[model samples]
Target chain A: MSLAERMLKIDRRIIFLVIGLCTLLPLLYPVGLPIRISSEVRGVYDHMESLPERSVFLLSIDFDPASKPELHPQAIALLRHAFRKDLRVIAMTLWVSGTGMAEQLVTQVAKEMGKEYGKDYAFLGWSPGGQAVIINMGQDLYSAFPSDYGGKPTKDLPVLDGVRNLKDVAYMVSLGAGRPGVEEWYVFGKDKYKFELGGGCTGVMAPGLYPLLRSGQINGLIGGLRGAAEYESLIGQKGKAVAGMDAQSATHLAIIVLVIICNVFYLSLQRAARTQRQIG
Target chain B: MDATILGAWVATGLTLLIFSFLYKDNPLFKLAEHLYVGVSVGYTIVKAYDTVIVHLVIKPIIENGEFALLIPVAIGMLMLTRYVPKAAWMSRYAFAFIVGMGAGLAIPRTISSFILKQIEDTVRPVLSLAGPDGVTFSMNRLSIAGLGKGWHEPASSFS
Candidate 1:
C-alpha cells in the first residue's frame, strides 16, 4: 500500500498507546516545566492576598466526583491560601452528590493547616433548594444553615462570629462544574447581597463566565487544571495540579506530532498522484 | 487491612476498570459505569433525607419548638399525593404553590442581577483619561499600554 494510504490506515491503538505513554511517563517520573500564570488566576491570588486577617471567605464547592480531578485541586489550593492568610472560611456545597467529597476535602485541608473547626472554619454541608439556598443565606445566614455540617448550631459557632449574612462576607469564590453554581451565586448571592465574587470552573464552563468577570461581577476566574496549577504555584505549594501539568504538556505534544506526520504524508501522496497523471 | 486502605484499593480498581474503555467497551467498563451511577444516586438519596427531612424539618419542629414549619411540612407532604392515583389531582395544589412562590421570590432578584446590574456596569465610560482631580494623561497612557501588552502575550503564545 502507498505510504499515504498506510498512514490513513494506522491503527488507532498505536495512537492510544503513544498518548498513554506520554501521560504515564511524566506522571511516574518528574519533570517540572515552568507554567505561565494567567492574569485571571493571578486576580484570584491577588484578591485573596489583599484580604485582612479574620476576614470572612465563603467557599462554595459546586462540583462532584465526575469533575473531582479538575475542581478538587482548585478547592485545595484556595483553602490553603485562605488558611495561610488567616482568613475565616465557610465551606458549603450546592450539590447534594458533592456534599460528602466537599466535607471530606474541607476537613482534610483544615487538619493539614491545623485549623480549628467552628473557630477558624466551618462546613455547612448540603441543603435542599439550589438558588433558594443562596437567597436564604443572603437574607439570614443562620436561617439558611442553622446547623453546621457536624450538627452543631451555626449561630453559636465562634467561627461565624459577627457575620450575619452574605453581605458580611469579605469575599466569596465558587469552584463549580455545572449549573446552580457560579451563575446562581452571582444572581442570588452576590449581586443582591453586594459582596465581591470570584469563580473557578472546569475549562469547558470557563469562557461562559468571562462576561461577568469583565463586568466585575466576578472579580476573577480560574479555569480547569491549568488554573489550579497556577494557583498552587502562586501559593508556593506544588500539589496534584502541578504534578499533572507535565503529563498534560507531554500528551499535547504527542497530538501535535501526530497531526504533523499525517499532513506530511497526505501532501506527498497528492504530489505523486499528480506526476503519474501528467505522464499518462 | 485498614478500611481506608481497602477503600482506596476498591477505588483504584474501579478507576482502572473505567479506563479500560479506551481499548474498547467491555464488561469491566460497563460494571464500573453502573457502579458509579448506582453509588451516586444512593448517596444522593441518603444525603437528601438527612439534610431535608432530619435537619430542615423534623429537628427544627421537635428541638427548636418551631411549630410554624408545619406549614411547609404539610405542603411538602402534599407532593406525595401524586403517588395515590385517585388523589393524584391534589398534587397540583402543591406544584402551583411551589411554582408560584418560586417565581415570586426569583423575579425581582433575577431582573436586578441579570439585567439592571449588567446594564449599570456596561454603561460606564470606556476610557477615563481625566479623573476627578485632573487629566493625568501619562498615567492613563501607561495603564492602557500595560493592558495592551498583557493581552498580546497570551494571544501570541497560543497562536
Candidate 2:
C-alpha cells in the first residue's frame, strides 16, 4: 500500500498506547512547567479573597467518584482559601452519591485549617428534588435544609447564625460534573436569591460555559485539573493539582507529536504510490 | 456482633466482585446491577414519601394551618388523576402550572444572571494606569489583553 493509505490504516491501539504513555510518564516523573493563570481562575480566587472575614459562602459538591480527580482538588483548594481567609463556609451536595464524599472532604479540609464545624462551617448534606430543592433554598434555606448533613437543625449552628435564604450568602460555588450543576444553580438559586455565582467544571463543560463567564453569569470558572493547578499556585500550595500538571502537559504534547508523525508518513506513502503509478 | 460492619464487608466484597467484570462479563455484574437498581428504587420511594409528608403536607399545615395545605393537596390529587384516562387531560393543567411557575421563576433570574451581569464584567477596559496620587502611572499591559489593538492611542492601546 501507498504511504498515505498505510497511514490511514494505522492501528488505533498504537495510538491508545502512545496516548497512555504520554499521560503516564509525567505522572510518574516530575517536571514543573510555568502555568499561566487564566482570568477565569483568578476571578474565582479574587472573589473568595474579597469576602470579609467570617462571611458566609455556600460551596456545593455536585459530583461523584467518576469526577473526583478533576474536582476534588478544586474543592480542597477552595476550602483552603476560604478557611485561610477566615470566611465561614457552608458546604452541601445535591447528589446522593456525592454526599458522603463532600462531607468527608469538608470535614478533612476544615480540620486541617482548624475550622470548627457549626462554628466556621456547616454541611447541609444531600436532599432529593433537584431544582425544587434549589428553589426551596432560595425561598428559605431552613425549609430546604432543615437540618445539617448529620441531622442537626441548621438554625442552631453558629456558622449559620442569621442566615435565612440565599440573601445571606456572599457567593455560591459548585464543583460540578454534569447536570444539576452550575446551570441549575444559575437558574434557580442565584437568580432570585441574588448571590454571586461561580463554578469548577470538568473540561468538556468548560468551553460552553465561557459565554456565561464572558457575560458574567459566572464570575469565574476553574476548568479541569489545569484550573485546579492554577488555584493551587495562587494559594502558594503545591499539592495534587501541581503534581497532576506534569502528566497533563506531557500527554498533550505527546498527542500533538504523534499526529504530526502520522501525517508525514501518510504523505510519504501517497507520493510513493503516485510515482509507481506513473512508471507503470 | 454488629450488622452495619457485616453489611459494609458484604458491600465491599460485592463491589470487588462487580468490578471484576471489567475484565470480562459474568453473573456477578448482573447480580450487582440488579441489586443496585432494586436498592435505588426502594430508596427513591422512601425519600419521595419523606419529601411529600414534610414539604408538601405536614410542615405547611404546621406553619400556615389547614388552609395552607389545600392547594398542594389538590395538586397531589391532580397528579393521581394521571392514572384515569378520562381525567388525564386535567393532569396537564397541573403539569402546566408546575412547569409555568418554574419557568416564570427562572426567566427574570436568567436575564439578570446570564445576561446583564456578564455584559457588565466583559465591557471593562483592560488598562488604567492611575495611581493613588493620580500622578504616577504603571504600564503593565498584557499582549493577550491587547491582541487586536495598536500600542498608541488609549482606545487602541492593547496590542
Q: Which one is best on lDDT?
A: 1
Could you estimate the TM-score for every candidate? 0.87, 0.75
Using TM-score, give the best candidate's number. 1
Q: What is the lDDT of residue B9 in candidate 1?
A: 100
Candidate 2: segments with Cα more than 4 A from true spot: A1-7, A129-132, A269-280, B1-87, B115-159
Query: Could you give candidate 1's per-residue lDDT for residues B1-159 as a string of tens digits?
Result: 999999999999999998899889999999999999999999999999998899998998898899999998888889999999999988899999999988876776676666655654554454343333221112113223323332122221100
Q: Please provide, for model 2 over A1-280, each residue's C-alpha lDDT reduced to its tens digit, 9 standing for 90 to 100.
A: 6556766787776666677677778788878888899999999999999999989889999997669889999999999999999998999888776776788899999999998888999988877778788889988999888777666878899899888888889988988899789888887776556789999999888997888787566899999999999999999987898899998888888888878987888778778879999999
Please write out the lDDT profile of model 2 over residues B1-159, one tens digit for every residue: 599699789888887777666556789888987887787667656655665576546865787676766786788689888899999888988899889987876666665566544544443433323322212111222222323433332432110
Model 1, docking class = acceptable
**Cα-based lDDT for every prediction:** 0.88, 0.80
lDDT of 1 at A179: 80
Q: Tell me the tens digit of each residue's lDDT in model 1 across A51-75.
A: 9999999999999999999999999
